[model samples]
Every structure is written in C-alpha cells, then in structure tokens.
Target: MSAADFLPRSSLSSLIDLLQQQGYRVVGPQVIDGAILYRPLQQADQLPAGIEQIQQPGQYRLIRTQGPRLFSWANGPQALKPLTFAPRETLWRSHLQADGSLRFEEVIETTEPTAVLGVRGCDLAALSLQDQHFSGDPYYQQRRDSLLLIAVDCSHPADTCFCASTGDGPDARAGYDLALVELDDGYRIRAGSPKGQSLMDNLPLDAATPEQQQQTDEQHQKACQQQRHLPAFEPSRLIHQGQHPIWDSLAEACLSCGNCTSVCPSCFCFSESEVPELDGTTSGHQRQWDSCFSEGHSYIHGHRFRPDTKSRYRQWLTHKFGSWVEQYGRSGCTGCGRCISWCPVGIDPLEALTELGREDVE
Candidate 1:
C-alpha cells in the first residue's frame, strides 16, 4: 500500500479495455472547442492524447503536443461535481388521475457505473468537499457511489493553480481509488483503496525502482513551485470587514454574470421550480444550478435582500472564502483557479481576498 510500481504505457489500452469490459463509462478530459472538457470515451485512443493546455486569467486554449501522452492538460472549467451533481435534473413528477386523484412518481437517478480517469488532486479535493455537501441527497449519493476515481498527480500546473497553499494538491492523500504519477516510459501507480488495489493487481506491472520514485518527487515539487503566490489571508478574517470598499471595486470589474460560480468545483447552490403541462394535469419538479450573483437569487417575500451588484459579488466572495468554513467546517474554495480563467473579466479571488487585508480598503 505504501510503495508503487510501474505500468507499461503500452498496456494502458488494456486498462481501458478492462474498465469498458466491466460496464463502466469512462469520462475524462478531451479536447473540445479549443479547450479540454470532460467527455465520455470508449477507447484510450479517443482521449486527448498528445494534447497540452494553456490556461491564464480569462483565457484557455489547447494545443497538440509531440508525443502520445494522455492527460497532459491540468483541467478546464469543470470538475467531477457536474458528473454527480447535475446542472439540471427533474426531482420528481406528479399527475392527476382520471378519477381526480393525484399520483406522484419519484425520479430516481440512474447510477451508471463510471470510471473517471485523469482526475487532478485539486478536483479530488473538490469532490471530497461536495461529497460532504450532499451527504444525504439521494440523487448525488447514487451517482457518486458508482464512480471509480483514478486520480492523476498534477505534474503539470497552471499559473492560476494554488492547491499547495490550500493544502489540497499536486498530489493526493485521500478520496482516490487509484493515484498515478505519469512518466515518459509509463506510470507509477499506487492503490488508495481496495478497489484500486484490485485493479493494480490485475494489471501487468513491474516493481518500481528508486529512480522512478525520485522522478515522481521532482515532478510533484515542481508543480508546487509553479503556483502564482497568493497573499496569506485567513478566510474567517473577511467576516469583520463587511463595509470594506473592495466590494465596490469588485462590483465594477464584475459583470454579475455568474460565470465563476458556474465553473467552480465546490459551489453547490441551486434553485427549484415546478413545471406543469399546458392542460394543467401533469407537472414535474426541477432543480437547476443557481448563482448568488443573479439579481433575483436573493429575493424574499416582497424584496430583494442584496439588490446591487456590489452586494451580490460580496456575498459570493465572502461565502466562498469566509462563511463557507462556518457552514462546512472548511473553506469552500479549493484553489483550482477556474473562476479566474472562466470569468469574462478574469477576477482573481486570490488578489481580491488579499486586497481585503489592506488598510486603505474601507
């Protein structure tokens, strides 16, 4: 359990075949629309092999690299959250019977055995947070229970990534079934759970050498060193600065479009509604992802609590970094940096939070 071994890169196809044979639909990063996105695949060849990514604040692009290396990209704007916690899903349905009686049918989510490959450690961290966030939610639980997490160490890091500062990544300690450190010749594989142990046992591999472990260590350290250094400011510290003028500056740069929340790995807010047939007989309840940045998200009985853009933006940043700890026993942001790349204006949460520590901010 402590040591790892090498899996010949050529035998990777066997792993995919094995997963497929076990009736698992493998979902992982693949090039789409000039960027990498998680998509289902039937073969290893379909994966974004030979692809590399370029990510920066408010920008993302994918380029073809020289060799056949899968999972060269760090991540796009998504994580495992969407695969388990769907963006839009029907909760249940009700229909009026011919005798005027009503019958309600529960919409149970189908659990397709899935294998999610190339999951980065930061995302594994986010998935852990979301697992706690949806503890008793049946829809989420069913889908999550069926996933086989194959986590890849973040050997390649983006400028926006700061998982090391959050104490969350570059490598994984928990939440993964299997963990991998990719090398040019093959991969160093370690089993994190019984499921992972079984898979590795079945695979053709050789005992790992000390040099391989050295390479893994070097790559991990290099990833940790690549993060854009963020100023140290505890999330709880922001709760006292309710009247800070940083809110106004954030509001100006923010479009209130809610792109950041949508792309975030840990944000789990949603709104529900009832939809009825035009004849008024059958109806279904639905839930869709919601953002606090929306104008109507804060509306109460007859008034919107946070009507202004500044108030909404403040709510989001504070909730993500500040109050989320009180709610979940940990900070909400995993430092994945999707919010920076996906935001239309590239609003960096790291910069915003650090600025709140300044004395000039009222």
Candidate 2:
C-alpha cells in the first residue's frame, strides 16, 4: 500500500494488543495529576481521549474537548528523553571488606523493545537527538537499536509553540515508524517504515481514499495556522547571533529553576552519585539527570565554567541551536513548548531571541 490507507480506531486498539502479544511492551500517554505521563498500557482504553490541554506563557491546564480524538492536542510538559537516559539510576555497586579490599558489582543492561504510541512531533525530534548522542557512540548502541516509535499528527498546538518556525512542528514529519492522522470518525493510518507496515498488516483498517488524503493534508495545514505563540527567530541563523547581548536580558528575569531542563525531551545530561548500603561498608554508584541551569553542573576543582545565569542560558541555547548540528547533524530542540509554558516567569525562548534582534541575523 502507498500509506494513504485509513485505519479504524478499533483496529488501533487491536494492533496494540497484537504488538504486546508479539513481546513488545506498548507505552502511551495517560493523564496523571492533571498531566500526561507515558506508561505501559495494555489497551487503547488507557489512552487520553477527548482531552485538550490549555497551555500558555506560564501555565498548563486540562480541558474537555467536544470531539473524540487521542492525539488532538498541543505538546505536554513531559518529554520522552528520560525513558532512554533514565532520570536517576544506579550504575554499579561497590564494597569495602574487612580485609580492605574493594569489590565492584556489575551493571545489568536493559534489553527491552518498546512501542511508543501517541508521540508528538517535537518528542519525535527529541528522540532523534537522543539517538544521535547515544547511538552515535558505541556506548549506547544496544539501547538505541531496540526501541520502536509510533508518532501521531498534532491537530492542535499550544499558545507557546512555534515549531512551525523551526520546521519541526505540529506534525510528525519523520523519525516515526507509524504516523497517524486523526479523522472525524476514524484515523488516517500510514506506515513510515517496515515495522509500522507490520503493525498495519496485523490490523483491519479501511484503505484511504483520495478525498481522505486531501483532508489529511488540509487538516495538517489548519493545525499549524491555529498556533499563536512562538519566537520569530530563524533557527538557521542562530549561529551568527550566538554572542549577542540578547541572552543577558532573558537571564535577568530567569530564576534558574531548571524546570525547563527537567521537562525538556532532548536534555540528556546526567550526574553520578554514590549511596551507602545499610551495612555502611557497601555503596552503589548512581547517576541522575542534571541540568545546565544547575549550580553544580559546571563545577570543577574550585570554579564553575558557567557561574552566571546569563552565560548558562546562552550556553544551553547555543548548544541546542548552533553546536548540535556539529554534534548530531540536527537541532537539539524538537520545538516542544514545555520549556515556555512551564516557566514560572513566562520565559519564552522565541520572544527572548527575537527581542535580542537575532531572529534573522543570517
């Protein structure tokens, strides 16, 4: 098939079961504490349905929708980065015996294949960034190769998003195994790769008509038009404006809370720690997620490379927009507005960059 075939919503449910039966753990978004969190789902019933989240400069709220759609909403605060880079986990264990010999324990490898459903476009991009960082090195090849992605088209966008500007937005254009576009009564299901095709083949969905294809195209356009928030910065030109004074202004109001990094999908930096066992003689070495905004993040012998908030913020933005291309061959940000909406002071990256007049430096 040419990928225009539409699938019944019920077929999606069945396909999830089929994947589970095939030994792939199915994961999707579910509402928890008024926020969407991804967890293992046995069936599609657990999927968030008819719920649209209202997100703005500094807040997020869940609102009921008039229609029944699973993926008809803006990006949420939670990004999928932690699933691969684990927020906090023990790397290994060690013990000091009575003989004063130090013994080391081995770290077990995670070997599970996951099927992620309802992933947004920005999240997809974030995953792509992580893949480059993890898989590009021999250290993370096994974990990266075992995961599968199933992305959904965004029919709605938040007030603080401008993914359209970065060309990442409102839809999953690539980096997805299967891409689904929600219709009035069904879904326009299409396979981006062989794994997606295998899932479609196991289900019974209606073949998409020319009219449906047209609607899908039109709907995607309309979704992009509905967004009202985003920065005016042209991502391609960020390199030229790297040293601009605009970053200083944005850092003044910033509290350096690290909330944005915590919720970001592409922020993969981590820190290691050691925890002592009950016996006080044994300890485990653990690693936890660390943010560039943190004080101790750039700590050295007695100095911090990025002691100033302004410098740290600029460093983060530059790495995401400028240096990431050199490191991963792509921008680190997927245009997920979690950083904007979750900011207590309403720190919009787009607005900050534009205010600096760095939007079109190229």
Q: Which candidate is the best by lDDT?
A: 1
TM-score per prediction, in order, is: 0.96, 0.90
lDDT of each residue in 1-362, candidate 2, tens digit only: 35536787766787788878888988889888898888899988788888888888789998877777877677667767766777777778998978999999867577698888888887877877787677654325555666788888888887777777567878788888888888876787778889888887777777787887788889988888876544555555666675677876878888998988899888888888899989988999988889899999999999999998988888788777667777887777777788888999888877666665544654
Model 1 segments more than 4 A misplaced: 1-4, 360-362
In the order shown, the candidates' Cα RMSDs to the true structure are 1.8, 2.7
Q: What's the lDDT for residue 207 in model 1?
A: 76
Q: Please, what are the lDDT tens digits per residue for candidate 1 over residues 255-321?
A: 9999999989988989999999898999999999999999889989989999989989888988988
lDDT value, candidate 2, whole model: 0.79
Q: List the residue pairs that clash in candidate 1.
A: 244-362
Local lDDT at 221 for model 2: 89
Candidate 1 Cα deviation (angstroms), residue 108: 0.6
For model 1, state the Cα shift of residue 264 in Å: 0.4
Q: List lDDT for all candidates, in order.
A: 0.84, 0.79
